[model samples]
Target chain A: MDVRFSPEQQALRDSAAQAVDRLGPHTVRDLEDTERAAKLDAAVEASGWRELRAAGEGRAPLASAVEAAIIAEEMGRGLADAPFVGATLAAELRRLVGAPPATARETVGFVADLSAPAVADRGTLPAGAVAIDARHSASALVLVPVEGGHAVAEVSLDASIPAEVDLTRPAATIAAGAGMERLGPVEQPLTADDLRRWTALGLGLTSADLVGVMRGVLSVACEYAGARRQYGVAIGSFQAVQHMLADACVAMEGSRSVALHAAWAVDALAAEEALAATAMAKAYCSRAARMVCETGIQVHGGIGNTWDCMAHVYLRRALLAIDVLGGAGANLQRVLDHNGIGGADGLR
Target chain B: MDFGDSPEEADFRRRLRDWLRDNNPGLPASSTSDAYWAGQAPWHQALYDAGFFGMSWPKDIGGQGLPSVYEVIVDAELARAGAPPRPSLGYLVVGIGHHASDDVKQRFLPGLVNGRDRWCQGFSEPDAGSDLASLRTRAELDGDEYVITGHKVWTSYSDAADWCLLLARTDPDVPKHRGLSAFAVPMRQPGIEQRPLKMINGVTREFGEVLFDGARVPAANMIGQPGEGWRLAMTVVSHEREPGELGYVARYSKVVSELGRQVKADPGKFGPEQVRDLGWAMIEAEMLRLHVSRRLSDRMDGISHGPEGSVDKLLMTAVEQAVGHAALSVGGTPHGDGDDMWLKVYLYSRAQSVMGGTSQIQRNLVASRILGLPAS
Candidate 1:
């Protein structure tokens, strides 16, 4: 068995990394700048990264979930203020619903109840209006409950976009009101397997993003420790700092391994196994990434707490990523549910 | 990348499984008893006759010349079948088989492979457990023999072993690590005395202390050149620490399954916390299996064992302890009475962190070696 990527996959990853590298180091200023976010989105679109999950003529898909995850991780490491995850998920949902391809400059936002479905705040406009990154999106693929299953509602995001904790990616609440166009209750009503597959894809990409954030933050922290001196020696020379960084490294590496496996499972394993793996990856990465980012800030000393440094940006992205799809507890509960430990009677 | 076995590997696994099913040796009544060794010898002989022993060693030295993955498969399958814990002569095989002279290999390796001899390692001293280089055991050469006078503790199977891989300082004036040497000493000598050290789990004579009052070993018995003991010992220890080699995942899988059965048997007795702990233990065990699989893949691709092995070691310790703790909590107070099996296991699991290397030392290794952090 081999764990290393093939040459073609490696090449794809390298090109993706190179494209995101052009964005340069993410700064506090980039967070609020809509122009920079738009620029980053355009660059990613030009790289054909947003179309990674799209199906082509008779081929299974142009790229596998593993490939999509690789690009997601790169975007995360760069902290690029692009709607990469949203756009990718939107393409996937659109494909599942047999919708036409999105226009060149038009980004597609995605919003669904990643956990259990409930009534979509009935009084709210467009009914269940969930917030998603829609800074540059013309519309969103919003999941709304139909009779038997969820349906994709193409809702306009022009009226409801708002700021989020993850400043790099703007969010907006979408509802099926007058301006929105309703899609299927698809030709085949969305099955539980379909929802699970979607959840697995979402978890894979989110966990990859978390893995990238932790690695990026840890690298910055280690460099800072090496350069920053207090008692006539690098702080990294001190045991406390060394141990902190070491623990972060271990956590990040473990998270990356699990995330990559989950991403591969999305395309390779049976539906149930894939769901379980996705839950496990999301649960582990959610906790690991937060710990690493927190330790990253700690390793940077006083400067880490400031708005100017990139440490808090990584932490913020990590915090935002954990909330996406679900937090650690939610995913862990999913793990237990999928592992047959749910319900009052054990071994359901 | 693929995680499942290749067709050849699958076939090999199937064949080994069938062999094990047919020639299954039931569990020994007692590990420290002479009857246990008597039963084990034939088992080892059958494995050797089947060409399973030394599958990863070179063909020139009577091995099958397969990749290390084959050996790993054997280990995994053995654990999967719930086979009795076979006597492990791998340390001696690796030490003498890899580094010893051709003469030494011909003399000892065949007996080891054929189960005619059992071997134990003598590296730790009472005062030098973690700080092994500080061991004061000394060996003085006179004529063609080295007279060893030292104390070795935590020597497993010392009573049953026919020989030992012992480490002693040959040049005291030199640096601690540089002055040591390794030798293959016969265990039946009158100069050597073994005193059983009862373990915390109340397992009597599971391991022991070997007192050497000038135990003599031939000069040619040295595995490597004099003062090369440190390097040799490190090689063996690294092998011991190697991920995926020990089949811990398979063993833990059984323990976890049994725990699940117990929980299922008495569902009303457990709380949410206990169930959650059990869930975490299972997750950790699965993660350990995955980690080991990835490491095996890496090894097959010619990656040398490195600090990443410490990652598996740390996880093993964590999973073992977690499962043990869950057993105790689920079994309730006075854990020893109703579930004495789990109680013994829990007691033994405490040594997981201490053996091989402490979790703290492993973290330091990861820091300095893998992360390139400054040593503290």
Candidate 2:
């Protein structure tokens, strides 16, 4: 399984990293209130990553998805708060559900506004148009029927908001019926195949985030161990400290391999293999991210928990990612269902 | 990169599983007193006769000389079968007698493989557990023999062991980890005392603290060079910790599967939580199996048993604790249904995370060695 990215993908990742580097260290520490959100948005525009990554030519949607994953990792490393993740999810959804309307824009959000009076707000409403704010940042609302639901909309959107912990990236909530146009009726619920695709996409992205967090945390830890001296010796020499750091490294590596293999399997169209791989990756990466972040904090001691410390940012991100997407158990159930094992009749 | 067993491995596993089914006693259907151990000796001998006992050992040394991965596959099958752990001491402490001298190999390995002898490790002491090298057990060399005198605690099955693999300090003032030697001491000899220690389960299972007062053994009994005991002990410890109940996981899976069938047949009695817990235990077992399999592949590829082994150890112990907790929760009491499958499993699972090395210690190893973090 040669899981290395294509040259184009690698170039994209490298570009993202360079763009992230422009933000400088301690930028993440500086993000506070509205300024942080604005900086993240600015960085996204500057990178052109959204357009470049989405447009890359690759037969494998999974591999193309991984290109976005790479971008996510870099964004995470920079602690860029822009909705790159949300944007990437939008792009993938567009690809999956067919191109959005030429004028459509997507932003992922929770708490979609559902109480808007059809006749009261926002210009002439097209017959049954319901203004739905999926992206808090979107200029326009995606209007679909109350009965249509969001999963099967056509005419690609510019922005789409996602709900909390939804494995398949959905958009965030916006003003109810504030800005959407009418689409056709809901065509389908997520089929098993659809769930499989959704799981890979979510898991792949989260796994990438985990790898980035781990890398960032480990780098800080190693730097701390090397620089921080006590008792006339670098604390790194002490067995107690060394073991903690070592565990984080090991977990990080395990998570990376699992994630890569899962992504690779998806690209290869090995569905059963991808299911198992993604489950193992998500489960292990979540655990690893937690382990590494905690160890990072422990290694840094009192300072690690402070607001100014970089470790705390990674720790929070790790916690959020681990809980996002319904967690390891949900993924395992997916795997169990896909593989037809471990359940009655081996089919759920 | 490949997780599936190779064709050869698959065939070997199938043969071993089939052989075990035919030769091993009936499914440990009940918590039949000693039914597990009762079948161990004969089964070990049968495996030895079939040349399947020590695939990792060199043929000249009475092993089949196959890659050690085969041993892992074999043990994995045996574990899945619910067969007793037959070579715990031999494969672990003795490592198929790899450290044993030619004479030692000739004398002890055949009997060990054939189940004519049982071996127990004597490492932990009242004062030394995690800081194992600080053990106070001393062995003073006297001409062709070494006079051993020290007290060893937490010696598993010492009372029943034909011989004890004891580590003793041969030098007084060197570093703590160094200056130690491993000896194969006969348990039946004079100057040896064994006092059974009751465990939390209330059954001794031959657990004991052994006292060696001037126990003499020829220097020939030493596994390797005089000061090589530390290395040997570490090797044995890694092996013991690395496998982490692969076979027991397999066997228990079967038992649990059977139990699930019975529960399903009488669903009126078991609730969703009980069923869910059982399902979780099964999933936990699979996770443990995958981790161990990866480690086994790494080991066979000559990768050092590094901090990753500690991860396995931690997971194993945690799963064991979780399984035990689930069993106890389901059974509604400690040691419920004296012969209840849940209770026995729960009781035994407690030992998994504690032995080899405590889960906390393994975590420490991971933090320092794998993550390269600063110690607190």
Candidate 3:
């Protein structure tokens, strides 16, 4: 099977990179530029990237999962501080349940611990439910249990919630019993398979983000290694620093390869198979991203620890992405359970 | 990008699975016994006879001239069915295929493809394990023959190989890397000696040492021009470390699967930490599978990976060692019927980082060559 992107896909990736580079933060202080953030949010909406999964006339996704993941990764690499994952996942949910796409930007609400989606009750959202990547979004998507399956629901996203660890994208927990509304005239109810496919996309997108974060941070670290000198030579000249950066590069490459496969699987393989692939990618990317980000900080030595350095921004973004769908530990368990690892009958 | 098989690949894979289901010779677990080694020879021949081997080699060399993905399918299916491993002599195939003369290729490749000409490599010496350019293996020109004299350690298939693709110093005055040349020496010739060496896991036939007072080969048997041995060695060495060349991902998958089976059969036998370790190892194995798939895909897309193969090598070592440790941790006490296999795996996994090139060497190559870090 071919894993290399087609020319169109490459063009999409390049375009996404250019957009992020043009509008994303250049320094931690840039996060305070509310006008720039609004511009980026508007630019992202205008790009129609948030609706990549919106149903076309044929009732299929406008673009494949790989394209959406490419946007997520580029956003992550440039620390684009905009709502992509949540918006894209919200669109995927709507497509799966045959609901009309959101008129405005939409994000998703995850339970407080961020293990799974928050299930909304009759016209109400739960307390301590986190809405991810919802800075400029009007509403966050939730699940409403209906006859035989779940129906698509939306709850208002409170943009005024307290700030979180990730300075780029905003993750806010809603108040208890917040008002909600279910999307209507449902052509199809969301089944277990539908949810599985959505979760696979979520996992794949987050994994791609982690790959981007690792690559971005490693690039910063390598540049620093070449410029920062100690003992009359660049610190990169030392095998210790070079080896550390090299290890980070390897981990990032490994994370990238698996993440790409996971993204491809979301559209190409069966739901169960795709879920397995995404779970593996999530585990690998989560672990490697954390290590690579730490290596980035380590390579910078003292400055890496300060708020001024960009390495921490990558680390912060990576932590949120790693834990968004499932982190190393959670995804590992999902894979094990999927494989029936501790079952009475296994390996058949 | 797609990960699914084409129709032809799917059909071939299905037939290969059917063949394996009917004819799988499930040999004994890893052992030092000649019986274990003997079993592999027939298995290799059976696979080649069924046209499952040499799928990526040129057609003139008895291959199907198909892309490498077909071979990957064979590898994965073989591991899935618990069948014997395909003979992992891709380094030799690459060395001879890329460098040997036309006559040499026509003479040796066909036999090599179907397992008629069993071969081993004589590259590593006791003093030249990682610093291979420093090898003192001498091949002096004597009439129309080169008399080779050297000692090689950790030589695979030493006891049974009919031919040995070896490296020796041909010009002592030149630079170490340039003075060396490659030779295809007959293993049964006079002044050649083989001594089997037992591994930590008790596998003897898999490794051995070779001593040569003067193993003679015709001057025409040199694989390439004299003093090009280092380049050829680099090619073979890089191929040796590649995961696809040895079908290592499939083996890792099998290891992870068996471990999962063990935990399932007796869930209470493992603690939470041990189970976590097993899960992590499974993820690592899956990562390598995905990584190798991408590499194969790149190959299919006419993309050649150079020093980036080092990245795969480091990842391979990590996966191997992680699986080994996980298997040992899960298989408590190592006293059950197949527990020794876990111990063997753990021991052998240590060699993955050390063999081909030490993980340290791999990191060095990646740092200096790929990352462009200054040498210090």
Which candidate achieves the best DockQ against the true structure? 3
Model 1 Cα lDDT, one tens digit per residue, B162-269 = 898999999999889999999889999989999878877666545789999988999999888899899888777766665465556655665666676676676687
Mind giving the per-residue lDDT tens digits that candidate 2 earns over B216-273? 9888888788778888888777667765423444554454455555555665666655
Name the TM-score of chain A in model 2: 0.73
Model 1 chain A worst lDDT run, 10 consecutive residues: A117-126
Question: What ordering of candidates by TM-score runs from best to worst?
Answer: 3, 1, 2
lDDT to native, each model: 0.74, 0.61, 0.85
DockQ-best of 1 and 2: 1
Please give, for residues A174-274, the per-residue lDDT of candidate 1 as tens digits. 53453545564345545677777877888899999999888789878888887888888888878888878877887776777788888888878887888
In Å, residue B204's CA in model 1 sits off its true spot by 3.7
Q: Candidate 3 at B143: error in angstroms?
A: 0.5
- iRMS for all predictions? 2.6, 6.4, 3.0
DockQ of predicted model 2: 0.16
Off by over 4 Å in 1: A30-39, A104-128, A145-149, A158-163, A175-187, A342-348, B16-55, B60-64, B67-98, B110-116, B333-336
The most accurate candidate by TM-score is 3
DockQ order of candidates, best first?
A: 3, 1, 2
Instruction: Please report how far candidate 1 places residue A162 from its true position, in Å.
Output: 5.2
